[model samples]
Target: MSHYDVAVIGSGPAGTMAAYHLAKKGISVVILEKEMLPRYKTCGGGLVYRGRRRMPFDIESVVEREFKQINLYFTGDDKVLTSLRDVPVISMVMRDKFDKLLVEKAKGQGTEVKEGHKLTGITFGAISTLHTNQGDFQAKFIVAADGALSPTAKLAGWKETRKLIPALEYEVEVNAEDFARLSSEVRFDMDSVPHGYAWSFPKKNHLSLGIASTRRKKIDLKIYYKKYLEKLGIKEIIGEKAHGYQIPITPRTDGFHRNNVFLIGDAAGFADAVTAEGISNSLWSGELVAEAIFESGLNPEKAGRLYQQKLEKDLLPELHTSQTAARWFYGYRIIRNMLLKRYGDFAMSLMTDLYIGDRSYPKNLMKTIKGKIMEIKNPLM
Candidate 1:
């Protein structure tokens, strides 16, 4: 078996980021991926500024559009916010291009990335042995950066907090002028979606339109999305190409590490429950775990424990708070309206913070609640 100091399973943003961090620190690491670089990944392609901040290299090469305006719509409630920020708050990207770009960057940093190697099994008794279709490899430490349906987590006997949110997305080409209009702004149409919402994010010359819901049992996502498109007066789809994927709403919040193995990103249940936005969280958590490992002086077991504790203290409380808030806002139109009206841009800024797993919300909660209460007291003042 080939030996290494670290083995990372998967090559998505989380895995690639972890490899980049470790390799930058001069650690021997290898990344195993089932598909080739820049493969198609079904995503909404919305990356907040926080996610962009975590990248080690410049990502301007892949950013299709910079978003300055965020429009939130509600059906039963009259809450709407059209705040334009001076700084670009969001960016649109194509995951196929974005994921591949990062992997190349990691390789440039001396990371060994092996594509077309599917992880079949893993034995974690003494030194960890990763069984893959390519061959068997052993490592002193393993980082499970594989996504939601992670084979690494399963093989390592990690229990995950589970809730699946299915999303259906369509990438349709549009006229350059129309695309330009979309690129300058992003819309979240809540009226068109009851339990979930419909989003329109512009990417270069294409419009990434999607609709999602998180009902317990699986329903027909296509039907819901088609109705959504029709409601928007999109009579004919310009591009036939489209994709879909699952979002784990209930993430592994309790803990993510076991012994010498650690899980990151969606595999570790680090996704935001309210928006299902996970890119920033994945990058942050990946970097956090890498720092913990380095500071541990390469002691895998101690690093794993410290990483778990810090993750819980630093991230889980906000996730729990957001999840609770999501359930409240989805049902109570009044609360949603009150929040948008009172908090306005400040509230949205806080949302950006929470999306990236910022734990400072406890200090901001009283202000949010006070502003919301004022809005509720007077509809228009």
Candidate 2:
């Protein structure tokens, strides 16, 4: 058995990031990954600007493409809206490359990256024992950054409270003509998946297309994806890879940590409610958790409290606001269409600001929406 200050489960963004920070502060940390590095991960692979900017090191080496412009198609093609930022609005990446880069950075910070160590069980105590496929290891703290279906969270006694939504993504290679036609910009088609949206994020040589609905009900994503492909005029198919997963847009009602085990990222359901984007918050939460433990001098209770405070100040509040925005943005169809048509440009800019980490969600969102509805476009209505 080996012992360390912290043992992290999984090497995804949250886990690797936490390990990186903790190791930087001289905490002995090891990341036990179930699979080898550069493994395929199911994601749309669109890293928003804010997330890219937050990285401690440049990720240019792993980046596939960058776009400063966004094209949003709402309801009908006629209702399309566009926004351009001076900085890249979204950076494209393959998770395998992206995640491996993160792990390498953490390793550089003195984190031990133990690939092929699958966490089978954990024994809780002042110092917890982590049973892995390779062997048993012990640590004073554990960071559960495993992802949406976090087994570590369950082992640490957390129940499901997150609002998990279904999403389907495909890596598609089209003919030269189709590739040329769609490869220049990033686009999202709203109302294509009922309350959700469909996105086309162009990679260096292919397109990562996906659909996600915010609604909790049952729907055929394949059916919607077929329609979306038709909508994109993608008549020829070369090769495609498909993946289906769930996004936890709501945070867990249960506590984030117990017995020195802390949950971050999708394990704690920190993805944005509106966008269902988890990487930004996941990275943020991982850093905070590590900071809390380091600052608290490894005091379990104090670290947990500090972590909660950090989240409440920034990440949690935004998630709450995102939930409110998502309710209006997705659930209310008529208002959504109307508002998108009338204020699409404004909305686009607002989202752009949020994506760039320049602004927070408005305080009185519903009030502002009401004002917009009653004040403008009087002639048409």
Candidate 3:
């Protein structure tokens, strides 16, 4: 049996980030990926400023476009455009190239990336054993970064408790006029879908248009996607097909670690409920798990506890705050519109700060929102 210090399942940003850090620290790490390198991943591919700032290496080579402003449209004529002036708020890149670049960086740091190796089973002992299509391997620690519907977490006896939201993305090749017009800014239409939103992220030669909803089973995403495209005046430019996937809207409340096994990124349900942004949290969690393992001296029990402590102190609090804010922001449309109409710039600035890691979601967000609602009701106040 091939033995290593850590075994990471999946080669997305989360898994690669963990493996890169671990291998750089001289730990033997192996990444098992079910698909071959550079496989297409269906995503809007917008890397927000927060996620970009957290990356250890420059991803300039993979970045296709950068935008300094975002346009938020609530209804037909209700909209707000927030500009960062000199700071780019989001960078766009195709996932296939982006993910491959991260994996290559990990490889340079000495992590063994075993492509096309799907993990079939896992047996726990003093040292956990991962049964894969390639072969069985042993490791002192296991990191599951597979994705929203994580097989590793299920195999490890963890329950599926996080809320899974549906999303659809289309890569459309547009004419010069539309491409040039849309490429200058990122646009989001909140009223396009029920309890969800539609977004347009511009890449080098195409636009990644997507719609997502937190409300389960009640939405026809395809119908909404068509409406969103028409609303943007680009329905005719849409490609032949659209890709769909599920995103975890919250973190796992039970726990993130069991024995020597740790779940990071979507596997641990780390995507933000408000924005549905996962790359930043995914990378952050991956780095944290690696740090915990190193701090624990490869002791699984100690590492698990340390991981939980780090999560509660740093990541979980933000996620919880976002969850509360999302409930209010999406639940009451009238109140939400009122708040947005009155404080659109302030709201957008707060969100921008959060995305750039300059600020966190306020712990007393609900109270603040309630106060705002009361102020709106009493104009004299």
Candidate 1 local lDDT, 169-279, one digit each (tens) = 888876655555566668887746567888888877778888877555666777877776665556545565777778876667456777578888888877777787888
lDDT of each: 0.78, 0.92, 0.89
The sequence of per-residue lDDT tens digits that candidate 2 reaches over residues 1-381 is 889999999899999889999999999999999998879999999999888887999999989999999988875658678888899889999999999999999999999989998889998999999998899999999999999999999888888989999999999999999999999989989889989999999999999999999987898999999999999999998999999999999999877888999999999999999989889888999999999999999899999999989988888888888999999888888887777777888999999899877898887888899888886757555
TM-score of 3: 0.98
**Cα shift from native, residue 143, model 3 (Å):** 0.1
Ten contiguous residues minimizing lDDT sum, candidate 1: 354-363
> Quick one: best lDDT, which candidate?
2
Give stretches of model 1 more than 4 Å off. Answer: 76-79, 175-181, 338-346, 352-360, 363-381
Q: What TM-score, over all chains together, does every model reach?
A: 0.90, 0.97, 0.98
